[model samples]
Target: MQFVKERQDAPAGFFEVEAAGLRWLAVPGGVPAVQPLDVSPTRIVLPRLTLARPTPEAAEQFGRRLAITHAAGAEYFGQPPAGWTDDGYIGNARLPHPRQPIESWAAFYAKYRLEPYVREAYDAGVFDDSARQLFDRVCGRLADDAPEPPSRLHGDLWSGNVLWTVDGAHLIDPAAHGGHRETDLAMLSLFGLPHLDRVLAAYDEVLPLADGWEGRVGLHQLHPLLVHVVLFGGSYVGRAVGVAARYG
Candidate 1:
């Protein structure tokens, strides 16, 4: 059988963290996770999945299982998996997953997740003074926010990472950690996941989301957008600014 292998020549413990994420997610049977066959500093090998078209049923199944997986819970906001230090990666971007002294999910996100990326973009000149100010407002208000318990998140759940096949939706290439469950759902909506409505519908049936969760999509999306701003270039800066503007 053919296998899929990911090779990365950067970071201190890149592949290891991903492999731990896959195992952590798979333990909850969240969705069909890529089989972690063999892992090494430079490579991770997994059994390749056959590609197929997506269906509502597949999407719904994915959603339901995703909720179950999330219900497994996490140690704390921004907590890393056991054995791995508080460090992670999102599409090659270094993510230092530090649990903030604050308690609220919004506070944790604002401090550890959003603020870091925004500051990075600012230092790199991707975010000008005006844009940085707007984003800072979002962070300030985060202390006033309340959210559900920290969930086992597929930290970067963008469309490219969710694969649809005959089996259902299988998640791959994750930056998994403890985070707000809505963050994953928000990411599923970001860049458009196929049958996303169906996915959310099924997920809601399994574990209902808080009211006005839809409105918070932009808020949860800020981190990834800023990540892109730092990782890529100017194109994502405007997108990040746009999302921050809405929250501000």
Candidate 2:
């Protein structure tokens, strides 16, 4: 059996871009990604997966596999997945994909990830001057860290996008791109994941994260929160500000 996801009013290449992301994230021996059996302008067809209760064992394996996926690396920050030539989407919002690879993750993130949505949120009345200031502070501070090559990110790794099945956790609905690996891990923690500690521990065992990574969780989380503010204005405004305040 298969499942079909359709959006009659989807933007041009919407489902196609998602299909590309899934294909790009498919690494050898990595955590399984939901296979797109077919894709078109308006819809994507995927294999049906049986949902199961989460388990610590499955979570641990997923962590190790995820580490491998990240290790695949990318040409540079903000580079779109292979086979895609233009921008991507995140929950119906446009996600920028630079044709030219950027070696500096900080520059790419500030320009492509944070700033655009910040402007959107501000225009939508979900962001105030104070919030914008906080984000500006965070952006300035982002360069404090040592640089690392971009990881092949499952850009939206929140728990809801991680489908636990009888086989294990299978990734779905990716905003995949070249980004900081911590962003994915932070996103996993954003909305809570089953056996999250085990997941982190196993991932660390395979590929240790940078020191002070725990402290930067809020930094990586800020983008998604801002996107929330843009897409759903309300408590998300306060939530984004709260996280930005920690780093700013």
Candidate 3:
């Protein structure tokens, strides 16, 4: 790998929060994260990784590593990284993170993740009028969701973020925060990942997922889907509505 520098002009803490998340997530001894060579308010330097084809062996290792990463836990469900104090970002979008303390995971997720972005999507013409009511029903019944401690989430765990190299699977471009571990796994399953079954298998062997986890897949998926509908504006809106209807 060679040294690569990325430069962008933006608000002060954009890259800072990103670097903070990288440092925070990397602390738990598990998955390989991109080595943050150097960081600044407006720029970051990292080892530019060479991509390789994914294999089950590496996928299983990555799954086990990911479990260890999540097991490190976090202070609270909606907690941001130590230095970054705001809701983080996914792609170019602003993600609302929690500053106010909420007791249960369901309350934090409902208040911050589901309702806010759904409102944004609806306001942006992505969702139809009745969509909010369906989400309201889901939010109302979050207590029915399986209980678990906050998992250190790589908030944007889509396939594009997971890179396979000769060394191992490395996670990149994280919107790192404290949220439900199921949310991270849900994002992994959202877009197809190579050798993903191997990954899930290794994950299950390490830290067993909660009961009824499969049943709640769509529920955990609601946040990212809602984000995409807001960002992309098409069939995703319909899919988001469909997921909300399940809980409704």
lDDT of 2 by residue, 103-171 (tens): 588888888999999988877767778888888887787783857778999999999999999889999
- Local distance difference test, per candidate? 0.84, 0.90, 0.84
What does candidate 3's lDDT look like per residue over 1-248, in tens digits?
65544556656567777777888888566887786777886677778888888988999999999999999889998889777887678776777787866698999889888998888987877777798778888999888357888888888899999989987899888888998898888899999899888999999999998888998889889989988888897888889888889888
lDDT of 1 at 107: 67
TM-score of 1: 0.95
lDDT of 1 by residue, 5-106 (tens): 556665778888988898888855578778688888888888788889999899999999999989989888888865677588998898878744357777
Return the TM-score for candidate 2, rounded to 2 decimals. 0.97
Q: Considering summed lDDT, which 10 consecutive residues are worst modelled in model 1? A: 1-10
Clash number for each model:
0, 0, 1
Estimate the TM-score of every prediction: 0.95, 0.97, 0.94
